[model samples]
Target: MEDETMSNTSEKIAENVLLLAVARLSMALSLPALGFVAYLLNLNLEQKFQAQENKIVAQKESSDRQANLTTARVETVERVAQSAIDQAGKVNERLISVETKQTQESAASERFQAATLTRLDRLQDSIVGQSNAISALTATLQADQDRNRPPPP
Candidate 1:
């Protein structure tokens, strides 16, 4: 019985010593392992930040392109509007010129018509005066012939 008790006590001590050695080894390795883990986490964060930066850069480029396109479109629209305004102005000028020319022609035609009417009125008055003079001459000639002839038998 004494031998068995000593043997059991020795075994318990050996087991405790082995557990303590394992715990010490884990504590010794934990610092480097934690540093490695922290390094890996930092690398992952850097990669994520780089990806965000790349996305921002791509978005900026796209925005610049869109702005340039909009500017070009605005310029084109302005040019077209200017062209239309110029054409309208030219058309207005031509219309005014045509109106002025028409007015001049109408005035001349009215003047010609008035002159023709006056000439016709004068011609009619001259013809009426000549007809009266012929009638008076014929009456005087008949009276003279009656005086020259003898009375009726």
Candidate 2:
């Protein structure tokens, strides 16, 4: 009976050891599975962050392109406006030159007219003096002819 009791005690100790070992194994296995799950979660978060960064970059590039296009358009409009202003200035200069030439021509025409009028007045006075002298000569010739004819009759 004593030998049987010792045997039973040994069997109980062996059974307890087996139960402890099984619990430790289960814990060890579960640790690796938990680590794998954590790795998967980290990968997913990284992918999301990278995708958000890429989207932001694309938006920034699009905004930059739009700003550049607007700047180019504004520059083009400014150039056209400047060209128009230059053309207007040229036209104004041409008009001023034409006016000055017209004024000069008008003055010259007035001077010519004045000179012609003075010459015409001198010619009229000379003609009047010649007509008076011719009349006196004709009267003297008529008197001489009458005296010569009466003495013959």
Provide the global lDDT of candidate 1 against the true structure. 0.59
Tens-place lDDT digits, model 2, residues 1-153: 989967976775576567546645654565465556555655765676576556556655655565565556555555776775665555556555655655565565557556645654564465455444544544454455444433321
Per-residue lDDT tens digits for candidate 1, residues 29-112, read 655665565566557656765765565556556656655655565555557767756655555565556556555655665675
Candidate 1 colliding pairs, count:
0
Which runs in model 1 stand beyond 4 Å of their true positions?
82-153
Task: Score candidate 2 by TM-score against the native.
Answer: 0.41
Q: What clash pairs does model 1 have?
A: none
CA shift at 140, candidate 2, in angstroms? 99
Off by over 4 Å in 2: 1-11, 81-153
Hey, what RMSD does candidate 2 come out at? 69.4
Q: For each candidate, what is the lDDT?
A: 0.59, 0.56
CA RMSD of all predictions: 66.3, 69.4
